[model samples]
Target: MNAEGKAGGFAPGVAKAEGALRALFPETPLQENDYLSKKTGARVFLKREDLTPVRSYKLRGAFNFFRKAIAGGATDGTFVCASAGNHAQGFAYVCRHFGRRGIVFMPVTTPQQKIDKTRIFGGDFVEIRLVGDFFDDCYRAAHVFAAESGGMMVPPFDHPDIIEGQATVALEIARQMHGESDARIGDSLVILPVGGGGLASGVTCYLRESGEPTEFAFAEPAGAASLQQALVEDRPVRLAQVDNFVDGAAVAEIGAEPFSHLQDFDARAVHLVPENRLCATMIEMLNIEGVVLEPAGALAIDALKNYAPETLRGRTVVAVVSGGNFDFERLPDVKERALRFEGLKKYFIFRFPQRPGALRDFLDLLGPEDDITRFEYLKKSARNFGSVLIGIETRNRANFDVLTQRFDKAGWAYQDITENDTIAGFII
Candidate 1:
């Protein structure tokens, strides 16, 4: 059993991964991030695996797995796998590369944007099977197809070869950091986002075995801190609930193989980045730095706030930006979350009088920089008053204080529903 992170030994697979992956694609960039270095007081380098052909590092693992399968002289009848996003895309691309028939099983609910991209990448070489409404249905369908057709299922990250392939990211980082020499990279820290644990585990093991004293920090979306929970318990534990907002890095449980390599680490070191805060970082990168990062991809960048400047000063650090499978349709929500987290927006339910100029009175309270984005009348709660939903946006977060002060002076009865999840979920 290729236990998570190849507990018994993994150097073999990691060693071969470097060569096997080159045929599929070149090594992604290891960029010196001037913006991040200035922010964190560290010599920050970004292992830009997201710049791969598929815009994700998953291609390395997928290619390695396929190469190993064929190298072992396994019959290439059909290759089956279940995935809706990056994994499926990587699998399809690799299958096409090898001239092998590939069947990709994706949930029926997969975004059309993803489906179209996968089809475009694979062309006629791949056939996508839209299975049940959820992931379980898709997984079961893939397994059944594999069994009936004598095909092999390519797992996302649960295999030894996948782990080794994922480790190629680290290898590439090491190679890119040097000036085309046999000189090894000095001690550095690698900050990686943990989802299925494939990338984190593979990179960690490969660096350790390479005899590099690289410090490692694992980042997980707060809504899906599976690694953190598992480490604290000293056992692999499944989350009772998970938020799929950061779909790329939201896993209910870290892979068994990944757990083996990461089990010894302290739980505190596993930073849980708030999804909304990550959205803020995403917008900041897009607007200020022109870096487009998906929710999970921003995990490492968002986590920078947690580490003190002194802790990172003068040290070379690398962050693995995992994938960029962001669906733009979610951008509005992302923006709203970002605004809320950054304190630039707020929502309130106001009880205003039905008398004339009541609306003007409320409007008068808004500062010069404040803009009312949403205003709706729900119903009359009393003969003299009605309930209204109000959303306000401002250039400065402090504008809310002035707005609230005006409300208090004007005898306005209001409930702050910006953070009222029940109301926001139903109405907003």
Candidate 2:
């Protein structure tokens, strides 16, 4: 594949960026995984961006932004960015690498582990500031601080420098494929996980420039499908609400610059990965392959399920594992989500008779495989009945169908609140 014609369209810039990246760390590995290959009936390669210096590809973009700012005569010696997780860590790592002062404003609600990781990465080169409870609040504070202190503000995405830096990942892929003896680089499928679209945009541009006849697919969290929305509207639109479960990739709005590069792709090429289903993918990787992945990191891998085995049979596919900064504290929640998505767990609101024997009667309906995970009584609605919240976990999903039938036959009143977001939000 020829990469000589293009100068600015991710070809020249990304090549230079790739050379510069060697100063910080070697290229992340692109290893073929037998597990995914067997599942899809395709040769699957994982671009393990999770193994990056900051445990994400975010370092590539942040480093490039700082490098250009310093080299292009930016007078400000301090850099500032607002992030709750991966971006903060990346920016801090780059600050330390370049011996520059950095101020990272993060939400007060950010986990201690993430905050500590950012501090460890930046060491003496960066200052951590806890601002507001939400990302928007801290983002506003970061802008104000940057303006007041005359510090250069680095955006998590939305900048050309950041995009170019991220394009280096694609450049590495092209180079690595070229070196592989059995790899068919030209006919491969490249699956990218879309956050703000920086990584996807950059990689697509570079791969096109490299003249690789590769097919591209994008995966976005269903609750935060900013990229898909942008493509649909032919312009970027801010979502009223975005689920932050896939924190690394949950963007309410796609970046303008990235959208410009990515808008050409067809809407059908993007897959919306459900947050709950993503938990299953994350657990599968962890339990089977010993790979720990954050929600967004599992996006591309989960997307492989979108295609049938026949469609991908004998094909070479690459899934970008975006990051691995998963907090073990959230493991229980991850497992719960996975079970719920798999239909092995459910929540119910039951009207129990206000009698001593009523509780025992309800418990008697349970099968041998059924277990009560949570049971709480709400306020009594009447003198004879009380509202009870019950969470059930079963070995088989079929048990729920039988249990519901038994409840109906016994004239027991119950409401399945497992998928009622509003009710679950308040009490669960």
Candidate 3:
């Protein structure tokens, strides 16, 4: 039970865990974000976990896991773990920190940026093995490696030591918030992003234990609402499909160990953020505040949109900006998702009449502010009617409604394939 942590409040030895973390790095900042504060009419502070050594709070867990295992007489000094990007980098960082030999398993399809960062952090202390094409595959491979090699497997989020280590973020937040504000901790609200439930569980447990009566909100990826689903089913259930756009926070199944600390919460407290909407948040933060956040990092900020301005007015709220390992190469995709989510961009399939002036007639239906971004003939050889894929960008979402009406009036045979995943995947 000690390994899984106590059932109530702070996990056993979490205080010690926090103390151990101080040697690793200084506390990450809790800076007030004027942009978000004004937008929601709430005092918004961002816990800049994105500013950590590995650009994430993951190092805390990985370091503590290795420290505990080594201190507890599990010699041989070999450690292993599986991760997508952030966790691998964190584990590698911590391995180099302690000068310990480590093995990291990551997906073969993991971005080059992440792979290079992990290598940079580990230096000579860690070996990275690219296994399968997904996290699950790499995870299984890590387990098999540990089993055969008798190496200690450092779980990304499921172990008690990891949970305790993650709790250090809450400890820092408590101290930092109290120092920065004259108001009681109870007056403040804490919003956390949930992936495998490690960060949320640890922070919640620590807050409760430290006698903070603060309000709490959990932000989850809409495509992978593992924590929300677990609360409903009263147990962890594997998701049928998981969108990995917010790769850091996308987990098919919530961790069993972390779930123990979070299972009793009200489902309403968990907000599911759409992938596209999260991209909008990322873009907003980057363009406005000059903060380049990964999709998972933006989840907590995006969840603030779930609350009305009136409800949040005058409230002091904190959001954990979970990570900033975003690859700039994906900027175009992020922009596209953001545009689509805002309704400023759309894709449509039109069955144009086989006439010489058909395109001219169709172009005339577009509003003044509308611009055609893509127009490709799906069947150029057709005689009677040809199918064409068209992508339109507009100044306003309302313009689309007006354009749809015009299309109907013109008797154009078209399908709004913007939201059609199947057609968009193949055609767009």
All candidates: TM-score: 0.95, 0.96, 0.95
Instruction: Answer with 2 or 3, whichever has the higher lDDT.
Output: 2
Which residue window of length 10 is worst by lDDT in model 3?
3-12
Ranking by lDDT: 2, 3, 1
Query: How does residue 88 of candidate 1 score in lDDT?
Result: 90
As for lDDT, the candidate ahead, 1 or 3, is 3
How many clashing pairs in candidate 2? 0
Question: Compared to the true structure, candidate 1 yields what TM-score?
Answer: 0.95
Score residue 169 of candidate 2 by CA lDDT.
89
Task: Tell me the tens digit of each residue's lDDT in model 3 across 130-167.
Answer: 99988889999999999998888888899878888888
- Tens digit of lDDT per residue, candidate 1, span 176-199? 877535323556778899998989
Local distance difference test scores for all models: 0.86, 0.92, 0.89
Per-residue CA lDDT of model 2 for 160-215, tens digit only, reads: 88988898889888888888888867889999999998899889988887787899
Tell me how candidate 2 scores on lDDT: 0.92
Ten-residue region with minimum lDDT total, candidate 2: 1-10
Error of 1 at 241 (Å): 1.0
Backbone clash total for model 3 is 0
Which candidate gets the maximum lDDT versus the true structure? 2
